[model samples]
Target: MTVDPFAKGGLHQAEAILKAHGVDAYFRSMAARTGDSHAVIDGRKVMLAGSNDYLGLSTHPAVIEAAVNAARRLGTSAGGSRALSGTLDLHGELEERIAAFLGQEAAVVTTTGFQANLALSALLGRSDIAFLDARVHASLLEAARLGWGRVRRYRHLDTAHLRELLAAAPDDAGRLVVTDGMFSMDGDVADLRALRDAADDFGAKLIVDAAHDMGVLGNRGAGLAEHCEVEDGLDLITATFSKAFASIGGVLAGPAGNVHYLRSNARSILFSAALPPASAAAALAALTVVETEPERRTRTLDLAEGLHNGLRTLGFDTRPSTTPIVPVRFADLAAGGAFWAALFRAGVFTNLVAAPAIPGGGAMLRLTLTANHDETHLATVLEAFDTAGRRLGVPRGPDLPPVRLTRGDGRRAGRR
Candidate 1:
């Protein structure tokens, strides 16, 4: 009667397979901290090649100080849900700060990025249709399922497919187009201008999940809309502070009326507890750093470029990456596990993305770069990868079936 999915199902089988391949890299608890960019795993000081701390501000003195100060001043928790007694001054300040930063009329903070995406629950009516990108985060998919709207999935980063789907929808149907600013695993960017054109032509509201892009891209660090110069074209933008901001919370920013509507009707935000004061303060501090320190983002992207080129030179397939996230494709799951084990031995830790996370049955090493990582770190990582591949006899890049480019945008790929 008490069946555990992880113990008895597909995940279990995958675990067995990984174990057979001698991969001990899956879930090691962090025992000690070696700054934001490095972690002590199994007592070995390894660099975090798979972390989401893009700007590496998690360990910044200012960010930590702000969190500590807030905790000291205002207790730990928010004490209640936003709809109840949980709303705090720090929350409002962060919301305002985020709204201004993103050039939005208003913003509402949520406890998690997943919950922030659930704002669609309030916006998607029974007669509405949600056009989703295939490579979007699972949160948006869950939101579409929870909402009253019908969901239609288009190819990842493919505005042409999105346009076709939109054209097929009922003319009177409320259209909501959803996509990621930067795909988490693929590391590719959405052509916002092209997407905006498609949405506008089809009379749709555009919603972007900029979880990986916020505080990482754009000249002003406002995420994809700003980076693509389509801020005015977007109807709503949702993102988490966990990545580049080095904080723990999410925000939904858009028009004043839309935000107010979501705040009032989105059950995910209304019923759930509000973000803690410490998180809010830390996010505020991180935002300040993100604004003042443009070099962090520049360094981050540049490092990613260098690392990506290095991987290519080593014959690893980094698929369609234009962001800090780079995923190296492998022949199969077993090859990936062996590579992971080898990298772990080499004192570099990277995440392994396998089936379920992806549509097709394959594995990829999903590594992300941060601003704090330098040339030395890059060299170490590249060297480790080289050793792992050569020793494991792993299949290299451009040899696999590439995501065929359909349009001139060069970002059109992904399917179910």
Candidate 2:
């Protein structure tokens, strides 16, 4: 009897684990959202603690109006590839706005964030050796694999390891270093200034995927490069509009000459349909909001700090996260599943990350906060966590001082 190739493969183990844990919750859908903080899931109202809408601009009046106006004027779709007939004045305007916001000479917009990375890897990696951080996003890893260059991974956030690898390379060989500004799963930030210095010393071009940092970090919300005051040192910066911009597209910004070259040569942009008019309009409007409303960024960081402290005080291990994205560490896969289910039942929603997303036998609950989440919403989430922690009998760490929530006036107050 011949063996069936489709019968089993690498996914069998994961499938078994999912079955054991009741796969119902993994892909559950939300029926509707009342606002940025609340969503209807399985006919129950649950606080949204797993979203990436850092600035809560998705439902903002100005953004919605811009999208609506674009749709009414230009319709929903860009009918062809950007290289063909898909280029719109709106697209050009959005690119210019993004380049100005990021303090870059030029910018190229792609259909998705993954495509931006893929284009870079396929184009640049062909001639250069790609040195990537071990914990970089999977899209970057896949892109490196597809590129013609030899790929090497340095230890996560270890500039020393990166420098060693760079030094060991042939003197004439071209080099490219890639990393994420904010690691998605762990929510820890990269030391961009150190990385920039190392890359400069080794004559390697640096690419930073700032998807999670955009609209949340930096003095003006240009992302981690600006946050680290290294904007001028980076060779290239890429980010997604899906998170903070409340739109669907990706942007790659750099020197004018390099960006022009990619506009003509990048296969993804040359062959794929252009970003929709509504998305471009929405992103432009969102950028305006990010620039004008500094308080939103302040509120988001404050909320994340409060939540992280609250979790730690309750004996839960929240990894070192100084941003709006927080990860609650679990002992193992089973424990994570149980905790997630409990949280769901308690009217709180979170993303369960396990196995392939995180190495080893560990798991975590990815809880993201947005600027629109108010004090009431946070209090309910904290209460839900306390109840779930007790019910699950999860181990706690040393008790710390109580965390204080920031008041409406921007002062820290109300310790619990």
Candidate 3:
């Protein structure tokens, strides 16, 4: 008899658990009308609390115009890798814009933020001892795994533990300390200043994946390094244009010589096609918006604060998060699935994170915010949570209103 490779592994186990809980709703297809605060899921219009479009620039008129203009001028795709025929003037413009925005000497754009991390990991960790945070993004972890280096993971957000790990490593070994500027799942900002200090003390190069922080943190939206007032201390910074920039690409920015080295040595950059002309233009335009419209950042942060407070008041455990990505924790996968379905039925869409994605094998409803969300939107979200929490038997604080189910037409379907 032939054996199925996945029949005995984690995939098979996951299937079993998903089946048991009827939680397959988590994987169902949902489409957004635009990258806005609402989406169409299973033909129902739902509020989008799960998106990464922090500044709400995804649907901005100028960004759309720039993408259209670039496509009209340079065709749809780059047609080749940057090493060959793919390097467009638009790409160079985006790189310059990013470098200028971040106060970095140079910047290199890649196909995705994940690819940027992968390329850096392959290059920087090839001969170094890579000390990674336990909760870093999977892309960085995969990069470390692929590189020919020894990898050690310390407790999440524990700089003291990080120092211990650094102290244990060989004195002569090339060391690389990698972490996320703002952890995506937990929504917590990293102590970049302390991490930079640790790196300096141990002679390790610090790489910060600021994908979640770009356009959301700092005075001018320059990201975590700027937010921490340690812009000059970081050795390298990587971020994605997909989130706040409302475009699809990633950037690695740093000293000119280091960026030049990545351009010449990173295999992903050499082998993969460059970012499309439309994406490059869109990213550049989005950067312009980030620089010009400071209120968008302020509004986004304000809305996030409102939601975080509301959730906490209702007795949800949203830990260690101070950013737009807020995760409401649950005890297990079943409870998370039920809570997610309850919210979905109530016309609020959120990302349900479960085992394998979440650390420590728990689950959470990953709620994110955008500047487009208004006071009414926040009110509606809080109301939905109240209803969902009640129906699911989750604990709640006092003074919340009774449960009400919302129909597809945005009217109250029924009251419980």
Q: Write model 2 residue lDDT over 144-262, tens digit each, in one string.
A: 88778889899999999999999999887789999999899888778888898999999998999999898888778888787677878888888899999999999999888778877
Off by over 4 Å in 1: 1-10, 399-416
lDDT of 1 by residue, 118-209 (tens): 87878788999999999789999999989998999998877889989999999889999999988888878888888888989999999999
Ranking by TM-score: 1, 2, 3
Q: Per-residue lDDT tens digits of candidate 3, residues 205-314? A: 99999898898887788987886778778778999999999999999999898899988888878899999999999999999999999889888877887787787778
Instruction: Evaluate model 3: give its TM-score.
Output: 0.91
lDDT scores in order: 0.85, 0.83, 0.83
For all candidates, the clash counts are 0, 0, 0
Q: Could you say which candidate leads in lDDT?
A: 1
Q: Which 10 successive residues of model 3 have the least lDDT summed?
A: 404-413
